[model samples]
Target: MATVTTRTVEYPADGLTMIGHLALPAGVERRPAVLIGPEGLGLSDVERRRADALAELGYVALAFDIHGGRYLGDPQEMLARCMPLLADPDRMRGIGHAALDVLRAEPRADPGRIAAIGYGTGGAIALELGRDGVDLRAIGTVNAVTTGRPGEAARIRCPVWAGVGSEDPIMPPAQRDAFTAEMQAADVDWRLVVYGGALHAFHHPPVDHAVVSGVGHHPRHAQRAWRDIVDLLAECLPISG
Candidate 1:
């Protein structure tokens, strides 16, 4: 019972219409698409039930909306509109390249099987759309933080999987050990599971501190981070049926 599609894009930088949610997978044609990025108190209902559970797992899920429809239950006014657009790492990579170009221009979305997932501040806008090279074949983040920007981890060219919370006091452990030593000195193809005692928006759930800013939830690390984000989008988008 999940064949959703709701739109309202229009984000020409700051005009801000935003509000997408596209879920489709039933008789999949050119599926494999995901662009969800909400968790700065914007696209709620648990991010449309995690984009309808990633469209019941056949993929084609888009759930972006960087707060244009404006919902701020006032955690300091949603952290002053998402912490100054996440402190402007190139305007969060132009809002994750305008929501990955609206999920690669829909039409059942394949675009070489796109992928992007986010949670806290949309996992830092899915790690700035994999650091901004963005031909994304895979990228998933749950408790993201690092926007330090030193070469930006060699501009990730996809294949990243991060789900943190080793008691995430806003991503501690020396900034996850300097973002895992800058994604292992920019070798890229990263992976960072950590989850021991879980905290910061551990896949979001118990929120009502006047609309979330803390009140951690770790339902078994949010079901093992949604099966490690569908096994890292089926090993970087591979489901052609």
Candidate 2:
């Protein structure tokens, strides 16, 4: 097994000090990199572990922050902060860019071979990065099928993969259709997976805290979605094994 190392990263973005988690494979030379965006709440252990897993796969991975450095356990607080933030594409790009800068600055990151993945609001930010014309190998998101301005999406030069639960009220059929239509209209190479019987944030591990309606966890689907993400990375940004 390859050894991995992780560290806390503090950076500035949108007048806030963003705290990110950086994980790297045990090597000197640069390797393919992945930028992980966490759920709306913040950068938690889940995302940090995802980064570590990617690093173990021989890629430099950085789990970027969302709410500066705090997690919003309350559903209302999360929505209150995320809704307006989601509505602003520029802000999303700024946040993504900030994290990208941190990841790219790592000596072990191959700037040219990079991908971005996110959950929920973080996923939306990842999409925004692609729409902003960042040179990414691919983009993957879970429970975040947010669309951008048609003209802006046209600037995306990479494939996009999004996964959502079929029964997720937060991302219902209408939203899914709209997202797909936007992607199609932009002529982007995009794919969507609907996990049957899953709910919003189904990709996350079950938490003891109370969540809003339509939120649940599905271990099976979560694993499947993760596998899909890994496959996407292997296809687009494969590194020598």
Residue pairs in clash, model 2: none
lDDT of each: 0.77, 0.93
Model 1 C-alpha RMSD vs. true structure (Å) is 16.4
**Using Cα atoms with residue i matched to residue i, what is each candidate's TM-score against the true structure?**
0.32, 0.98
RMSD of 2: 1.0
Q: Which ten residues in a row have the lowest lDDT in candidate 1?
A: 5-14
C-alpha lDDT (0 to 100) for residue 206 of candidate 1: 76
Local accuracy of candidate 2 as per-residue lDDT tens digits, 1-241? 8999999999998678999999989878889999999988788999999999999999899999988898899989988989999999999999999999998889889988899999999999999999999999999999998988767889889999999999999999999999999999999999999999999999999887878899999999999999999999999999863
Residue-level lDDT for 214 in candidate 2: 92
Q: Native-vs-model 2 lDDT? A: 0.93
lDDT of 2 at 139: 98
- lDDT: which candidate is best? 2
